[model samples]
Target: MARMIVAEMCPQCGSLDVRATEPGWFRIEWDRRDALDGGWVEHLEFGCRDCGMTWD
Candidate 1:
């Protein structure tokens, strides 16, 4: 079986605490940022909660 490349680790702390920065229950308005930006501007983002780093 061929292994697929999934993600690039966080550079700062080298922690795997990275995931899609989703809008939680309290902040439904956060979803609007996606539409305002564009098709994939803030919609698909990677965030590392470990060091609190978020990026597109």
Candidate 2:
């Protein structure tokens, strides 16, 4: 199943059109079960849909 993301108010424009974006290639999540191989892989980023503002 896919995850649902709630939009947040933009600090610069005050619009509830914020969305999470992935700018990097990937991210690692340290999990106990995956310790033998490596960490969980993931990616994430944040930005405002209306204003096109991005954050780290």
lDDT of 2 by residue, 1-56 (tens): 99997666778888788787656544455455376445433656668889988765
RMSD of each: 6.7, 6.9
Write down the lDDT that model 2 would get: 0.67
**Pairs that clash in candidate 1:** none
> Which structure among the candidates has the greatest lDDT?
2
Q: List where candidate 1 sits over 4 angstroms from the true fold.
A: 1-5, 22-43
lDDT of 1 by residue, 1-56 (tens): 99898875777788788887544323437668566545343345677879978776
- The window of 10 residues in a row where model 1 has the poorest summed lDDT is 21-30
The models' CA-based lDDT, in order, is 0.66, 0.67
Query: Local error of candidate 2 at 42, Å?
Result: 6.7
